[model samples]
Target: MKIHVWNAFASNNSGSYTIVGRFPSEELAAQVAAELSEVLAAHEQWFRSPTAPRSGEGSRRETPSPLRAFAQVHSLTQGESDWADQGELRAWSTGHQVFLHDPCTLSLPDSYEEFLRVRGGKVETRIRHAHADIVSLFELRGTLPKKTKAETVRALVEELHADDGPLVTLAPFNLQPAWREGSKPGEPVLTVGAVFHDRDLATGFTAVEGLARRHGLDVTVRVSEEQDSRDSLAWLRPSHPPLKRKMFDVWLLEAGYSPKEVARRLGELRHGRYVDVPGLLKALPDTVLKRLTLSRAEQAVRFLREGGANAELRPAE
Candidate 1:
């Protein structure tokens, strides 16, 4: 089966391009690229705010050189690939950087003076341009006090109806690095990944704190005045749900896509490893069946039906 992948790259006037990520489809990659462009525009607006230095106030110029950012998408195949230029944007400043801060380790700078303190050192007390780090959002990623404690958090979160609120994720982290560094033997690190936008910090803080205190869980909850979240938290985002939900079984009565094509299209939808379609079709007793979400199953049925195959969905019991 042939599978396709797309990569998004951005040049943030950093003198070189950095890979944003790989996506299941070009459309998804393009969407992220557009968001990055929007961020640059917002950064320019912040630079032009009233805090900026006035003419002859300091060594600072009335305006800084405009910054240029470009993004590109590449489509990959087994052998060959194609590249497409997404476009570029120009903003007020010549520098752009995104940082994810650890509040406990370093307090983020709020004003120009604080910005210089965090960024600059002795001999350079102050500088020319006005700069700041816009706290974008807050993220939570940590290990539960106990392995089984995860279920408690989930239950408490559900009790509070937080399942549908801020995105909640529980995944394992490899402790191999720690082991190699003599910190501890390799062990399963259950990491929590949750993101609360700036506006929703109150809800997120209360829920997480309540969960920890009520259950005696060791997870710490903190909130900052400015926009806050870590860059590593972005790694939690994926094209598909991390955990599977109840799904609908799609059945094809006649020959639809060859098992090969079925694998390709479904892989695009699922965002997981390749499914063994031919093997499953042969092992099943009757019609070829596949499990997918209701919307995804409907799409599968449509594609199969258009190919002259009778297709339908059987709700999972």
Candidate 2:
């Protein structure tokens, strides 16, 4: 059995639902689902910002959270897991905007295809044009006051609006297609959300707080330094065309990452990807270690340990 995190989006009296995550166990699925729930609850009003003032609706009362999106845990038997087998693996390379799928019930009419080919590996959709389907995203990490949340987001949107839309950060989970190509395009992708982009924008969105002077909305935007690995490893399987260090630009090499070594070691992993030191550091525990023995294979680990000399080390699992 597999557990799935089902997400639904609603606006203008219509909405759609799809699976965002599929986990082998209920624990992880529940965790992800709960996180998404809290995120949407904290930030939903941001998506529900009025395009124009509404007339005669009595007094505006705060609606329950998730006015535009909702998420919950879903159970599936083995037979229902067949959708995972239909798609081909695609390597996620940087330098292009990849649109996985827009599950937003309020998005503009889509301008991209909605299918995956077995050999062609068009399983993932990425576009090159800047204005085609690009959007800025700012994932909110904390809660906000319900009374002022809508106004807070309105100010944010107004601040971010240059031509397209404001940079919005919703839940971190990726919504999987309700059904791929050959099947009809799901209603979820029909309309554009106030702001929705399946992937992170090439640029960052950290300057939101300074835009407005008054509202104390607690929003934290986390922009991953390693977008290449973040995008490629977001899904649950191996990539078809393996990612290599050479595929990355010179900036990474100039930043002290060993390109030749990255190229060599990427091929060695099961997924042909590398999770850098900073990523590993974030996942490590805060407990400090006295003296730990290391193996030759852990030479890199030894090198890192030598730097802090007082750094913590979680025991290897």
For model 2, residues 183-273, the per-residue Cα lDDT tens digits are: 1332111111112232322222223333422344322222222232233223323321221111110111121244344333322321222
The prediction achieving the highest TM-score against the true structure is 1
- Show model 1 residue runs off by greater than 4 Å: 1-245, 248-291, 312-317
What TM-score would each prediction reach against the true structure?
0.27, 0.17
Model 2 — which ten-residue stretch has the worst lDDT? 174-183
Candidate 2 to truth, TM: 0.17
TM-score of 1: 0.27
